[model samples]
Target: HASFFHGGPNGSMGFKAIVNLLGIENYFGKTEYNNDADFDGTWGIWDEPFFKFFANKLSSFREPFFSAIFSVSSHHPFKIPEKYTGKFKKGPLPVLECIGYTDYALRQFFEKTKKTSWFKNTLFVITADHATVCYHPEYLNPWGEVAIPILFYAPGDSSIAGVKQAVVSQIDIMPSILSYLHYSKPYFAFGESVFDKNRKNFSVTFTGNYRWIENDYLLLFDGKKSSGLYQYKTDRLFNNNLVSKNPGQVASMEKTLKAYIQQYNNRLIQNRLTPFSDLNYKKSQTKNP
Candidate 1:
């Protein structure tokens, strides 16, 4: 996929498999990742401290800069500061350990940025790249669900302030920022604007393995097996697989998910749903997840 935030290796096509299968008009993406990162061993990931750097330093100059940070430390190797090397007692705590550290890093960044003049005027919209691997009873299908987080912070007048209470998705965040700055935005983007609460509060999270949503209810579809059901409102963590339990509701959410899926799906077609990111945060990142 073409990433306006991070550059992709395939450059223009961004690895569009079955490329020729889809008409040229249908195949659209940037030539490569937006740009190359000096510290970026891999091409488009905005790994850890990188986000802090972007937020605290880069944004001051780039008027239209949209910071897309991925916490690398929170990823596989789970590399963290030396100070936290032996921190967790249980051999390794949950992956959330680094995520927790990332939050501290972010807060420190804000503190340093506050000393700068830009802190007051900038609009902050924080969110998670995706959910965690930890599947406690609370997170029900941690195996299948992607609890991507969304946040809103701004040095603006309204819109992104305290908790919105209303669920917001990363997709919706872009348009919200555009609207906040009163910039011209595209009409057909998949995400909704943050302020469009009156519109249906819909969010779709497509991971390589499964997809989930929290509309009026919590629903998950593993791509092949029809769908699964759970009441996300009541089941904060999807403890019970309500698909068999609530056949009626499961059928409805599956229909909604499928209906939305029909709009566009080339990305998911090839199973390239791996998060196009590196760094990640803990609970603080995605407001909801």
Candidate 2:
């Protein structure tokens, strides 16, 4: 099941295009969407309906299944259900209150699912699409804007549980899951499997400018040059730019960032994202010439 409570699969052109390209448009046994028009012109239905859809759909699947659920009550216009109006204390930002409501809904969903037969055998991965408004000054920096929680929960296996000190991102989810399932096939992905001990964990994000995070350092790059470098562990606010002071680190991270940009650009240009038989292309020649 690929269930969405907010935007349907066809809502975004980019999303539709990617799904079509990957040939995963019909991959799910069920694709559920919230039709707001049925609710007398209301948009953004509550999260409960989504949970119910997941429960009902999963019950019908006889074979192994992969599913995704997207929750949107935490998003704007930031409406807290009438039943939860005064439940949570008002925070600095309106979104925080909405977050409380959404969290409660998630807790309820889990409580109901834990009694199910599949709950003990499932691997539940929780993550947010993006972060909300930064209320604290410390989290107002470029790195902080992209900061969101990523958690993995395998009910029967306790070995993979607990905190992972390594940095990871949303892109790593697919590869990590494939690795966990012991998938033996060639595939193209921008991210390495986080569970692969031999692979270094890092995250790359771009919103107008580019930011690359590896270990303790974060390097920010504009189109032409490295503008800021900070030890995020020590400098949470990013007030200090160590680009001039740490030339070696800047150069190393810049080289990595450039390689990532080149690979991404090359892939998009060549339309080699999908692992189809006909579109045989060599590895990206993004290495320094």
Candidate 3:
């Protein structure tokens, strides 16, 4: 499979390293970065034309190809093209207009892509790397800090529609797509398929402290111990600390979180990220036996 990546920082060390790892043909917005018209003055190229450029490049790619674009127009020091300055509605946050511009850019990209033959078969997954500034009062807590949009859309697939009532993270995206494609090979992933109704889905996030969300409860772990526990579904404000009140819940969640961390750290340290690795085999044997 061929992969394409666009958008990165000045040095692009991190992005280039990932592209190299994926064995993808390296592509970046170096030309746009150098051009004044394409640059948003704050971020690199404006999302509108950059997305169009990416969409045009997609047509040249062969079948069974993976492409990713990281947009930059809807970020800090939010600025949109002069022509669209008064177009989007203004909200409490300055980023809202920028977001609206980015949405428009994405829509334009889709419009161009719809003309392509491969657009119908492709699964489009949209998500952000992280959530930024929060304006709503309910989202002032830890859970809200990590809560970002995750959406999957296929051209005519009704089965992929509707909201799923489960705690899912970006990590689950890979497994879920593989499951939908009926990929039978055993793989090493830190997440489970969201389509597996029998499985308990959860999202773990770290922002200085670790937060583990399962069912309705959100457990806050500070490495040493579970510091705070809140029924996030009900306690949207996270005003109540149920740490002392829920010992059993704390212990169970903490145990799982610790084990997950151990596995993650060990794999990374040992350079054994694949299922075929000896570390994974040993770990699986010990767990199963």
What's each prediction's clash count? 18, 0, 0
Could you give me the TM-score of model 3 versus the true structure? Answer: 0.92
Model 3 over residues 1-289: C-alpha lDDT tens digits? 5554555444453666677775776455646345566766666778888888888778888887778888888888988889997999879999999999999999999999999999989989999989988789899998889998889898868788888888988999899888878999878789988889886878899888999998889999999988899999899999899999999999999999999999899888776787678566688779999
lDDT by residue for model 1 over 113-155, one digit each (tens)? 7666666677776776676676456654642355566766765
Which 10 consecutive positions of candidate 1 have the poorest summed lDDT? 274-283
lDDT at 84 for candidate 3? 92
What candidate 3 gets wrong by more than 4 Å, as runs, is 8-10, 32-36, 278-289
Worst 10 residues of 2 by lDDT: 36-45
Give the winner by TM-score: 1 or 3.
3
The global Cα lDDT (0 to 1) of model 2 is 0.73
Model 2 Cα lDDT, one tens digit per residue, 1-289: 3422333334432544555564544322113344553221223446655556566666666646666766657766777767677998768888888788778878887887788888878888899988789778888988789899998888888888678788789999999888888999877788888788877767999898888999899988897899899988789888899999999999998988898889788778877776752145543333322
2 against 3, candidate with superior lDDT: 3
Model 3, residue pairs in steric clash? none
Deviation from native of the Cα of residue 252 in model 3, angstroms = 0.8
Candidate 3 displacement at residue 247 in angstroms: 0.8
Best by TM-score: 3
